[model samples]
Target: MAPTTERASIFDPDALERVRRELRLHPQQLRVVRNAYFKTFASEQETLALFPAPERVHLDPLPLHQRLDSTLDGASKLLFRTSSGLLTEAVVLRPRSGRSSLCVSSQVGCAAACRFCATGTMGIARGLSVPEVLGQVVAAGQLLAREQRRLRNVVFMGMGEPFHNEANVSEAVARLIDPSYFNLSPGKVMVSSVGVTDGMLRFGERFPRVGLALSLHSVRPDVREQLIPLAKRYPLDELRKTVRELNVMQGRPVMLEYLMLAGLTDTDEDLRALLAWTDGLDVHVNLIPYNPIDAAPELVGSSPEVCRVFAAALKEHGRKTTVRRSLGRDIEAACGQLVKAHTLSERRAPRSDTSSA
Candidate 1:
């Protein structure tokens, strides 16, 4: 009896028939041939680069808003959309000097739920995708360049939890750092997290050269948790430990973001806790006054006197600190304010129609 001959299928049916005919394979051998050909073709496809050809569909060269208008027919002005699905909806604030920066969203709505933050009230929706995350930078870059400006920096203090969305956020960072794409230096980017230890650790490993900011509103555990619910899950002690590890790993000082709320979490005790937690660590404290929101009327911005006292205490402890002046206040560009207004306006519209009818 003759031994069975192994046959393989060529991926192209016509090619397979030609080869089979040329080889004059037996009927059984043809079945074996077909299978082998498909297996090899599938393997080759897997290794091939899948990104769309750069020339076929170019991202419009026009500015961000213009592209947006062209895409959406100028209906929706780029305001804060819910941060969960899109991660964050942002307005590309056209810079006065043509120098712009992106206010990127870390999470959809913040889980922090800080007393003064509208985003917090909305709660965490979802994390943004890598492309969605990078899209914000691309949008800002287009808008800025239209006005003869360029993006100088990127702030990840927008609507979402950056640390929570670490994977996508890191991917987006990788894209930004790519020269063919945004080509942004790691130094020009800043990521703010509400002190999630696991996320922080991973972020440090993924982006060792990027800037990190801890949203350290109140160093006291109880007060901190009250201001940010996530604080309950990750206490100050744990957070401090994480920050120390991150600092050592990155070999750079981390930024401490302290939001001063009037009469709340701004006492001498708060200052002492902050100093203690940050003691012997390389860090810079950025004091940001509470951006007022209607959702929490009780929360108010800290006065200059209170901010000064805290700054002095931090200085006394030999910790570096700087006060952040509020920008875009008039345009509702302050953190959470734009989203809050959008939410309020949306709610009022239905009520107004009902009353009119």
Candidate 2:
């Protein structure tokens, strides 16, 4: 819990307004502070310099604890620490296309327990607050601003199942696209889910322009259940129906995220099932290469040739498909690999007590 005298989060406009009223500063002064902080993504010091009473405002509620840059690609993993010492991760992806993107987490850990996901192995600690979620964008945006590049996209594809934290995630999205806040285009924001049917419907209805991706790794009921334990609760048929509804609600093709596991989800039978399942649905298929993780030793990614062949087969069937370029493999920031190893190690370390006498 925050202390009584804790500074107000810059993400909370109400709190900032209250602070402004208390300080008796001109309204334009607060607007300048907001423009510098949210729009320009200025450094905390620089943003605070614009305000008369900097001591009363807190720029970042979640302080960045560590950052790891990938040696093989334009990807950087940022580890942030909450006030309670819990850790969450966000990834900055600078693909060759030059449209930089940020993947932010909604929870410290994940409860989905997907067999192949490292974060899923760690039971969820807690859902992030709205401020915590938006702070990631602020931090990442400032980092990109330093490099003279703006963050073009934000995806809820980092460490946790987004629908599980729907309320906070939804509130964060509201502020992200709100004209007076982050002011990003709704089309550039996406929330990926593991088939939370009700939440998906609600989210689609609320933010019709925002992209929604379903983690439909497998259409086979048994196989899907094995890969994603949450599948058992929301059956494949139900998920397909929800996707159809989302298509109509959003008036856009829903993204179906398919993970390619060699000999598991890449076989001829699996492809046929996928084709049959998506026969008439207006959806785009994204083929994601499986990133190897120690927790799931049996799951290996399909070969490049196999992925190409799979994509070719999809295109031949009139299905829109694109093989996603997996980034940050060397830094363990790729898909299914965002478990905070440092946080786990810290948890295992013995602590010493030095109480003042």
lDDT scores in order: 0.63, 0.88
Report how far residue 198 has shifted in candidate 2, in Å. 0.6
Instruction: Return the top candidate by TM-score.
Output: 2
- Please list the residue runs of candidate 2 whose C-alpha ends up more than 4 Å from where it truly belongs after superposition: 1-7, 335-338, 350-357
RMSD of each candidate? 12.5, 4.0
- lDDT, model 2, position 181: 81
Which window of ten consecutive residues has the lowest lDDT sum in model 2?
348-357
- Candidate 2 per-residue lDDT, tens place, 144-165, comes to 9999999999999988888889
Candidate 2: pairs in clash: none
lDDT (Cα, tens digit) per residue for candidate 1, span 69-90? 2122111124423323122455
Q: TM-score for all predictions?
A: 0.72, 0.94
